[model samples]
Every structure is written in structure tokens, then in C-alpha cells.
Target: MARFTIGYRTVKTALGAAVSIFLAQLLQLDFFVSAGIITILCISITKRDSLKISGERIVACLIGLLYATLIFELLGYHAVSIAILFLLFIPSAVSVGAKKGIVTSAVLILHVYTVGEASAALWINELALLGIGIGVALIMNLYMPNAERDLLWDQVKVEDCFRTIWKEYAKYLKEGDSSWDGKEITTASTLLSDGKSKALRNIDNHYLRYDDYFYHYFAMREKQFDVLESILPFISTFGDTVIQGEKMAEFMEELSEAVSPGNTAGYFLIRLDELREEIKEMPLPQTREEFEVRSGLFYILHELEEYLTIKKMFKPDPKRTHNVSGKRLTRDLNKKGSKK
Candidate 1:
């Protein structure tokens, strides 16, 4: 059974709806319940989306009032007239990029239709309702819980998965036909996807000063993941372990240990270059099988170098150093727990 818990969005919606309805009632507005409904509709997952939708809805509501006033006064406010009005208004709203506002506008239009008049006082009441609903929802959306902590947790999971994946690569090279199920690769893909989504949400939360640092970080890691996927076939083709395979496996172990958000890629790149030169000096393969295995090792090394090169070109925000440190510490703790 799924656990029943009231999320923050639910709390905000309930509180915002209550406040809107109460305020509308205190002012003696007709159809005060509509204000609460509007508030509920306006509440969104991101502050930016809420603000954007609220603006669209407000503009569309005003446009709806205009259309209703002209149409109702001319067409006698019949049901067919309402259909004609929607046919015209829907197209107009869509053309103006107010498609998301159609529902809210329809609600306000129904209020005018029920009143059977397009009087100035009725429009004022509707405007007041719109203001109350949108205002309260905007205020509620302003208190979005900080997502940084959750994003940090996602970052840790993604990094840990990457480390495990690289470790598995090293294991495969060192001991061909091992029992590793390649689960870490799938887990890393999922974790990277989820982390990137959370990072984008974090970016959306900030309106003016957009912090896309985490988003870029995840994107870089995703590119590196593609390289890792490409290396899998090469790892699978090795039927017999050669001397070069063992050396590359040692390099993979070093790479796996250095899988972090830090700028240690340059150091590794130097080490990788030295390894490449050393491999070039090694004796020629005596058998076709050995030659194929050595060639696969070189391909794997090339891909690994690309992986490090990607990290080398990418730079993280200096201000986030402490946060990365905290994630690393948490990851280390989790690793210890898993070992137990």
C-alpha cells in the first residue's frame, strides 16, 4: 500500500484556497467559492510556472469579459451564443499564447453568463475574484521549499552509481567473465535522469538569477555516461586477459576512485597519457586473440580518456565546493553502511 502523506503542494493549495474563499466572502463577492477554485488551479509545482500561468489567466479572463460583454449584448445570451463565443475566443486565446488560461477564463465567463448581464459592477466583482485568487496563489508559491538539499542527495546517488559502474568496468577487465550483472549502468542512467530533472526544477525555482550550474554538471556527466556505454562492447569482447588488459584495469581502478565532482581530470589525463605511451612500448601480441584483446583495451583506454577530457573541459561553480564535500561525506557513510 502506498503511504498517505500531505505534500507541501497540498498544504499550500489547502491554505491558499481557504484564504481566498474567506477573503472573497468577507468582501461579499458573488460566487466566492470560485475564488478558492481559482487559487487551487493557479497553484503549480514551480514558482515560475505559477506566475506565468497566473498572468496568462488574468489576461484571458479580461479578454473573456470583453468578448462576453459584446456577444451577450448582441446575441441575446443564448446557449448557442455561448458556443459561438467559445469558438471565437478559443482561437483568439490560442493565437495569443493564452491557451493555458482557457479553463480559468471559461469559469469567469460562466459567472458573467449566470448574472445575465455585462454590467460594470459585475466585471468589477469578477476582477476582484481574479485578483484574490491569483494574488493568494502567487503568495503561496513564493515559499517553495528549498530544493538544494534534495538535489545534493541526488548528486551523491548519481556519483556513487558512476563510481560503481567504473569499478565494474575495472573488474571485467581484470577478471573476464565475472558475475557482475551490469546493474550499476542501468542504475546510473536512472539516477542521472532523475538528478537532471531535479536540477532543472532547481533552476526553475530561481526566476531572475538562474543557477544552471547543477544542470550543466548533470549534462556533462550524461555525456560521460554515453562514453561509458560505448566502452561496454569492448569490455565484452575480451575473451582472454592480456598484459595490457591488466594495466588498463589498474587505470580503470584509478579512474573509478577519482570519480568525483572535482577538477582532478587533468591529473588523470597525465597519468592516462603516460599509460598510453607505456602500452605502445610493450611487445607485439603473439596470437590473433591476444591482438584483439589488446586492441579492445586501447579502445577502452581511448574512451576513458574522452571521459576524463569531458570532465576536464567542464568547470563547476566555486561556491558549491562545500556542498560537494558534504555530498561526498554522505556517500562515504552510505558506502560503509552497505558494506556492513
Candidate 2:
């Protein structure tokens, strides 16, 4: 058997359902159990989603009430009348983007049929149940646990992974080959994907305001990761180290140490330019093998420049107080808080 644990959403669902049912029963509404079901359905992963679905349910339920009264009264509450109502109602619900509330509205329409009348009192009672259920769900969703701390930690982990990957690349350049399993590449890819998803969920939680800081951060990392991936093939082609490889190895090691969300890319770009010129000024290769190695090193250098340029263009939000190594990250790490 799979182990089951109660998470925040689970607890909120249980509590919201109980509160909805209690409020409905207290108000003496018919079919009060349905209110609990509505609450369970309305509970969503994000506050905005909850509110959007709740609005859809309320609107669809009211539309269902109107259809149920008109059709059931006109057609004498027959089974065929319910079927006809659905044929017309399903299209109408879908057209208004209330398709998510179809089943919820169907339940209320059945309640109207069960009551066997279109009285104003019956409509008010059903509306009361709807309000109580959706209202309780909205209240329950108001206290989403803060995810910013976890997002910051993910950012740190991604940078650490980048540092490790660069160090591995440097090792490959310094020596012909290393025994690295290349797991950091896989790990960084997974972290970037997961981080982007969580950041998007965070965006959804803040409906009234815009917050895309973490989302853009992860996206920037993903672009840099693409550059890193492109460099891997170049590293694999080198079977022997040349004199240029040693210089490139040192540059890669330095880049590894500089893998925070900092703008130290400008300094690195200048250093890379000087390194290119130095390599150019060196004596010509004596053999084809040495020439190929030199060429691959230059290719790697070009890719590294692109990688750094990506970071240089990124502008992290200044107001965010996310920390790296227990120190607060400044608005411009290269110009302000960076060691460079």
C-alpha cells in the first residue's frame, strides 16, 4: 500500500469542506452535503486558480438553475427533459469557459429537479449553498505557505551545479579525459525545469501584482545551460591537451568560481579577449593533432563568451533579498557585491 501523508492542500480541503457543510446546514439549506463537495472541488493549488474556478462554478450554477427551471417545468420534469437540458447546457457552459464547473452545475440542476419546482425560495437556497461553499474555499486558500525561501534555495543549488559542471569541464581540458559521469548536467537540467515550474506557480499565487523575478532567473540559467551543453561536444573532441588547453582550463576554473547570479561576466569577457589574443600570438602548431586541439579550445572559448554574455544581460530584481552563501545578493553583483 502507498503511504499517505496530509499536506497543506489536503488539510485545507478537509477543513474547507467541513466549514462549508456546517455553514450550509446552519442556514438550513437543502442538499447541504453538496456544499462540502463544492468546497472540495474549488480548492486549488493557487489562489488565483481557486478564485477563477469559483467564479465559473457560481456563474455556471446560476445558468444551470435557469435552464433547469425552464426545461423541467416546460417538459414536465421528464428524463428526456434532463437529457435535452444537458445537450443545450453543455454547449452553453463550454462557450462561456465554465466547462470546469459542468459537473458542479449538473448537481445543482438535479437538486432543482428533486425539489420539483422553480420557486424563488428554491433558487435562493441553492445560491446560499453555492456562496457558502465557494466563500469557505477562498478563505481557506488565503494562507498559502511562503515559497520564496524554497525558491532562493533552488537558485543556490542551480548555481552550485553550474560551478561543479564548469570545474568538470576544466578537468577535462587540463587532462585528456576524466572519470566524471556527467550527472551534474542532468541534475542542472532537472533543477532548472523544476525551478521554472515552481516560479510559475508562485506567479499564479500573486494575482493582483506582477512577480516574474524567479521565473526570469531560471530562464536565464536555462539559456546559459544551453551554452554549456554546446561546449560539451567540443570538450569531448579533445584527446590531448595543448598549451592553449592549459590556459583555457585556468579560465574555466575561474569561471566555475564565478557562477553566482552576479554580473562578473564583463570582467571575464575582457579576460577572455586577452586570452584569445595571447593564444593567437603563440607559435603555430607543429602537427595537425595540435592544430585540431587548438581549434577546439578556441571554439570552447567562443561558447564561454556567449555563456558569460547571457549572464551579463540578466537583471535580477533589486528589491529581492535572496542570499547566496549567507550573504545578501545586491542589485548588481558585478558592480556592487562581487569580488571581481
Candidate 3:
């Protein structure tokens, strides 16, 4: 039953089409069925997209009306004239970036050809029908209730994928195992890419320009994912799980747990600084192999620091402030320390 349930968009499209048909009939417009068809074509998943498409459709209809009127007046609505009309009309529409309107424009041109004349009254009827259809679709799509919720869900899914990848990296570091499947790396990359795309679509669904925080947030995460991929090869080159490796593994485990919206990466940055100082105090690498491994670890650490810095520096929108209170987060950590 859940799987079979229809979405709000389907219901809205049906209702809008019905309204357009009824309005066209009431107005006694010629080719009244076009109103219903146009409504169906214009109704999209998002309000902004619906409006954009409807505007394009209207412009395309006007182009078709102009072309059909000129051709019918000159060639007298014959079959060959209709063919010539299409050859000229299609190119003009495509040249003006109204290629999406090709089908709807064809319908409008055919309405004139079928009537055997290019009368002004018929043009008025077609324009009225277009208005009824596009207006109804715009009205129906004015509200989208689930866009923000869906964006949030995508954000969480992307963060979860990132957590999994970092946890896998921790496992590889602690074990120094070459047998890691590396599947989560690919999975995380795909998830981030998809998440960013969905977030952009969600942004376009809204009317306001200010509701783009999720899009920016996903973009930042995408940059961090690139850094994570760079760190993977460094982690894979370890010969043994030394003390420094174990410390980094522990840090990664902590980081994986902390990967969520609204959480600051300040604590992680501080811990990284401490770890860097600790590494400096350790004895220098004794062999060429040891130096190479040590240098790789340092490079990985530097990249991780950059990744955390990107998150730490991000300023979320004030109106859409989903961030947890820094003081409250610090207090919660303190309480955990006390309990320990």
C-alpha cells in the first residue's frame, strides 16, 4: 500500500488538468482539449520549474502562432504549406532557445491549419487556452511541503556515507591490512555526488533565493570527500600499525562519530594540533622505508587538517541555523569526561 500510494505532485497535476479543461470549456475557447494537455505538460515536481516551463511554453506558442499565421496567409493552409510551416517554425523556435516548446507549438500550429484560416479570433482563443492551462499549473504548484525535509534526509544520508568511509579508513590504519575491499570509498563518492545534485534541485524548487544553505553545505562536503580520497593511498602504504598509527585510528573513530550537521569541528582541529606536536617530539625515522612511511602519515594528517578546517570555517545561514550550540556541545563533552 505504501509503495502504491500516489505522490502529491500526481494529485496536483490531475487537479490542475481538470481545472484547465473546465475553464476552457466555460470560456468556449477553440481547441479546448489543448488547455488540459498544456496543464499536464506544465505541471512539474517543483513550483519554480513549473513556472519556468510554463513561461517557455507560452513564448513558444506565440512563436508558433506568428509562424503559422504568416504561412497560412501566404500559402492558403494547403498540406504542402503545413510542411513548409514546420520546416521554418522549428528552426526559429530552436534558435530562440524554445526547443522544449516544439510539441506544444506543433499543436498550436495544427489548430490553425485544421481550421483552414489564420483568423485573429482563433489566435485569441488559443492564447486564452494557453493562459488557462499555464495559470492553473502555476497555482497548483505554489506550495511544496516536502522539499526541505527531503533535502535534510539527503544531507543525513551523505553524512552517514562519509562516516562509513572514515571508519573504514580507521580500520585499515589500525590493522595495516592490504585486504580492505575499498568499496565504501566508491560508495561515499557516489553518495556525495548524488546528494549535491538533489540539494541543487531542492533549491530550485523553492521561490526564495535565500533557501540555499543545504546546497552550500553539500558542496563543502564534496570538497572534503576529494581530500579523503587523496588520504586513502597514504593510509594504504603503512607497513605496520605503530603507536602514531593507533593514535590516528582513534582520532578517525572519533571523527566518524562526530560527522553530523550542526556540529563544529573545532575540537577535532585542537586535537590535530596536539597530535602534530606529539609527532614532532618522537624520534626521527631511522631508515629510508621508515622516512617514506612517516612522510606519508604527515601528509595524510595535513590533508585531514585541511578537511576539518573547511568544515570549521563554514558559516551556515542565520535564518536556517541548524547548528547546535557550541557551549552546549562543549558541556555535553565535559559531562561525558566527568562520568568517565
Q: Which candidate's TM-score is highest?
A: 1
**lDDT for each candidate structure:** 0.85, 0.86, 0.80
Q: Output the worst ten-in-a-row residue range by lDDT, candidate 2.
A: 325-334
TM-score for predicted model 2 compared with the true structure = 0.91
Query: After aligning candidate 1 to the native by TM-score, how far in Å is the CA of 106 from where it should be?
Result: 0.4
Which candidate number has the best lDDT? 2
Off by over 4 Å in 2: 319-340
After TM-score superposition, what is the CA distance of residue 329 in candidate 1 from its true location, in Å? 1.1
Score candidate 1 by TM-score against the native.
Answer: 0.93
Sort by lDDT, best first: 2, 1, 3
Instruction: Give all TM-scores, in the order shown.
Output: 0.93, 0.91, 0.84
The Cα error of candidate 1 at residue 87, in Å, is: 0.6
Q: Which regions in candidate 3 have their CA more than 4 angstroms from the true location?
A: 1-5, 175-187, 318-340
Query: What is residue 5's positional error in candidate 1, in angstroms?
Result: 2.3
Pairwise lDDT winner, candidates 1 and 3: 1
Model 1 residue 105 lDDT score: 93
Per-residue lDDT over 181-277 for candidate 3, one digit per residue giving the tens place of the 0 to 100 score: 7776777677677777777777777786746677788888888988988998788778674545777888899888787665468999999999888
In terms of lDDT, the poorest run of 10 residues in model 3 is: 321-330
